[model samples]
Target: MTDFKYETVLSEIVEDGVRCITLNRPDRLNAMNRGLIDDVARAFEDANADQKTRAIIFTGAGKAFCAGDDRREHVHPTCEEEARDLVLAIQRSTYAIVLNHKPVVGAINGWAVGGGFEWAINCDFPIWGESARGFFPEVSLNLFVTGGVSSLLPVLVGLNTAREMLFLGERYDATQLQAMGVAWKTVSDPELMGTARSTARRLADLPPLSVRAMKRVLNATALTDLRRAMDLETEATIAGFMDPETTRRLKDF
Candidate 1:
């Protein structure tokens, strides 16, 4: 199969039937902007369509995995409509990752916060480096998690742990994340990508049809219907963004 095409924020390659999509915004800690989100969605779509690609791995380019949304772009007018739009965009990005039929593993090397944390949570498996840290610090900025965090977090780490993470807005190291059931395993920083690639290759070696079917079955319980979940998440996200309080908080940040 042909390799996927990507731009500044994304890099794609197919190796051993495993497609690797790397977030390439190292200068900004690989923070998600409009370009990154667009590229990521396209990359996932492309990977899913490639018959040779049985699994996918997502990682970052710099010292950090993703620091969430670009703060520079987020500083804007405290308008309800604009906030709603921002939320919808975020939901779309998250849904893209979750709905992709191929198995996805998030190789978190450094820090993943806010929307980044939400993105990692949506992946089928989360493999972290010893230095990796994850958290939902949106509350610290007076903003709430919008990218299916309400649904995914509770399922991944339970209601009480989710509440603590959301409420405290503190970072959790890889060890803590593993304890909370959010991280599948922690590897040394140098082995992070290699470990993830090996894991993806192993998945790729499985019967593709059966693997896909299994994923569908597993997702059915967490996500009743992929399309329906996406729709609801999109609506809730937009509403949250359009809220007066949220608008004000976003503007202040």
Candidate 2:
């Protein structure tokens, strides 16, 4: 972490062993492009390996936690390899959080749309702000959810609820996600960072080895399906990316 100077994100370790990683592209509402995606993967990898950091708190720097992928920079791949690589980069970034030995928490300051929702949900759990909005505009935009959400989301919110979010490309506020039993807590915007850091510190105070073992066991059992679903999603996304209909729809949107 010391050698790398991150451009799309900022990282600092707090006194209580909680490292805060704030997505830094405020002008773009902290949207995920290649740089942000790579930085996230690298940051989480470093945080997990850092003995001084016991838990991580992820948030965004400006009005939004993340506005999702930067669509203006989004690419439509011409070949299968390019398509798969693009999707895989995205997949790896999300998986990096899961791969961490320490617990990860998201503090959603505002918008968490599309891939942003994936990032939020990928954390062990998320503490959201009251003003935060979550949604998947992917279907309309001719894209698919990049993470293993195809498997994980249905488990949290039920199949029908997942369908509403995925198929219909619907929006859900923080309160609604909290009610659905997805979000950990909903705090006022001003309390977002404080609440997130407090929670991370609490988690960091647990027996370190036990916490790591617990996470490993939980992931092995709970994420078995997620691994398979992510693979399928990647393959399908690449094929879909080249579809004429999808291309036309993407351009229209």
Candidate 3:
């Protein structure tokens, strides 16, 4: 992990063979920009390949875990090719987390909106702070979600609940999400990182080979269409970007 460097992410080995990766754009509430998204993808890939890093604790730096895209400073693709590249780069972060060999523990400290909520779902264990909230704002923004959530959400909370979450874009508190089986546990803000670190420690202590095997087997059996769903979502999102209505909506937002 020491050999790797990132512009919008901070990686360091925590105790008990666990690596803690923090999203570093606190000024922007860690919103997903090109640099942050690329850094997250590379960071997870590096952690997956590092044998010494047994588990990963993923969290944000400030009040919000991630405010989704940096709407104010967001990049706009001028053409379909640029839109495809942007969408692919956004999807790559989710791939790194979901397909990583090592387990990822999410410390959802605050608002996990849109893409941030999708990333939280991508974690093997998502722990939320009591005050944290989550919701899908993609539909409202004239965009679609990435992160294979198109396949995973319905399975986690059922088809009806998933539709409500995605279509209505209402916020759900930490306790509510835990009850829906989307969050593993909810703790106070002060305990958020500690709980996540403890969870990572437990994972680190497990038999690595067995854990990895279980993850691969479970994903293979349960999420067989994950890649397809992601691909579809990417294409849909590209269409959203190319639509003039989306540009108008973004401007109004």
Q: What is the TM-score ranking, best to worst?
A: 3, 2, 1
TM-score for each of the candidates: 0.88, 0.95, 0.97
Better of 1 and 2 by TM-score: 2
Clashing pairs in 1: none
**Candidate 3: tens digits of C-alpha lDDT, residues 64-144:** 999988987788898999999998988898889997678999999889988889889999999999999999978887989
Residue 189's lDDT in candidate 3: 90
Query: Can you write out model 1's per-residue Cα lDDT over 210-234, one digit (the tens) per residue?
Result: 9888887887777665555556656
Local error of candidate 2 at 233, Å? 1.1
lDDT (CA) per prediction: 0.78, 0.85, 0.91
For residue 185, give model 2's deviation from the true position in Å.
0.7
**Where does candidate 2 stray beyond 4 Å?**
1-4
* Of candidates 3 and 2, the better by lDDT: 3
How much is 107 displaced in model 3, in angstroms?
Answer: 0.5
Q: What is the TM-score of candidate 2?
A: 0.95
Q: Which one is best on lDDT?
A: 3
Error of 3 at 92 (Å): 0.8
